[model samples]
Target: MITFCRKSFIKNVFNGQIRCKSANSVSLSYNKITGCVTTSNDSLPPVLIFHGLFGTKNNWKSISKAISSKTGRTVYSLDLRNHGSSPHTSGTDSTLIGMANDIELFLDDNHYKTATLIGHSLGGRTVLQFAYLWPERVEKLIAVDISPLPTIPQQFFTKTTFIDELSKSIENISNDLNMSSARKQVDDRLKPLITDAFIRGFFLMSLHKNEESEKLFWKFNLNSIKHMLENEYINKIEIKIPFNGPSLLVHGQQSDYVKKDDYNAIRELMPNVQIVSIPETGHYLHIEKPNHFIDCVISFMKLS
Candidate 1:
């Protein structure tokens, strides 16, 4: 038997800031991280997944379901702040460390002492920040196609090359999301700008209807993401404490995000970490090869 849990609670209860034992915190408004939880076994530690930039909790539905179904353990696929149904924040509050703070609040609200943390791309960086600051809260950590340092500008360029396309697509689509043809309209508009059908479909996954207002919207905070690209593209990950627990780095063989030269630097931060490269995959390796990706993560947990 399997159980599904969806949470949308008011998590940020503090007035000013709630600093973790690591003494790290981020600014925010009244925002909460939304997640879909799947559980088959309550005894095993829970697993929480954070998606990459422009992705939502829905992106990991299949993987989350598969993981929980296979291992009989709880799995949570979360929407990072300023993305998905989660509230959008302004400039400084939407950073990787800030997202880490949101994850901290998420654990506290759920009363989870520790969990297996898995993240991809920007999400991978967010989990690393969390593991570094709150090492005790993470039972095991898996990062997909990411490293401790910031990605080069080419990274954002290649992944988000469809920004101009996206902007033009938004202009062409109807404002009323309630229309039955809204989804098709979105797809049609994006066709010209984004030539790759697969990448276009992946971007299409970010579309969501606002039931209350019947208005068009994206799951991600575009301005905040652009801010990161412009200003913090080269900013190093902020972490003083090294997480020495069970850790895995799952990178795509075809991706340069985690280069061969980064192994030693990563090892210095996480001495017990192991790196696995998925053949012929890119930054979105999990989406391209979910079964292989799932096997890697589950096998790592079994060993840990």
Candidate 2:
């Protein structure tokens, strides 16, 4: 059911100490917002996961763990640069293609001739670009609740609305307050729009204590993310090759990201793309309806 080729694509990229279970293992330390996670694993086409804006590898832990346990395959959830553990580099270099290159290099370094890449929101765009660049390297691609086309971020929360809420929450946080208290304050402010308690909690988790100043700062580089908001979300990259690999494009029936107009272009780029619409869910379809998301993935992976 799995075909893992044991061959080195790019040798000596990392020290020879980068061990593997088979010859098909390459490890690449990707530098992003925080730092990097060395990804190297066994046969069974590995699942490379990418998180959305304001998310980290930790966000994908639940679904990834479940997927790995159910399928017995290696699942890699990456924290894109400027968002999670990946180290933040100067400038807002958050191009979709550029981010995909990091994954490509990771695959090359880790001996994985091909992989199943799953991404959500901003990450969906990144994965699309990745497959566009290296169609042969992707065995399967899953895009959750987002397409390559531009969508309005303000739909989540109007600029004035988010700013006003954040400002009020910031004012409540004192030097003496604990993370729990700070999170509670922020949660109270975000409650109206972000109904999911778990997501609200996850966002709160990104807030870290500054050891020196004793102030709380977000782990993600907000500046870099904000800077690329316009440039990164646009539908600029055209797929040169119609990626013939198995593709699953899952979207929420309530989400505006994947509109009817998108179908022609999506099918044009990937003639084999399959679309699944999860009803009663919005942009955060996976998080809003985890079971449905898992079921769709399981059914698709089992096929062929």
- Which has the greatest TM-score? 1
Model 1 residue 77 lDDT score: 85
lDDT of 1 by residue, 78-178 (tens): 88777777777775555666788777877766778788999998788889988987787789999999978655437433344455556556664556544
Question: What's model 1's lDDT at 18?
Answer: 38
Q: Provide the TM-score for each candidate, comma-separated.
A: 0.81, 0.78
Across 1-304, the per-residue lDDT of candidate 2 in tens digits comes to 3333234323332333332222222232222221122332355788888887778888877888777766667888887767666767433455665577677667765678788889997778888888886787788899997765555445443244443454455554687887777667767877886787876777776777778776766777665565565344335555667777899999988888887668887787778889999999988888889999999987888779
Per-candidate local distance difference test:
0.74, 0.70
User: Residue 211: error of model 1 in Å?
Assistant: 4.5
Shift of residue 155 alpha carbon in model 2, Å? 2.9
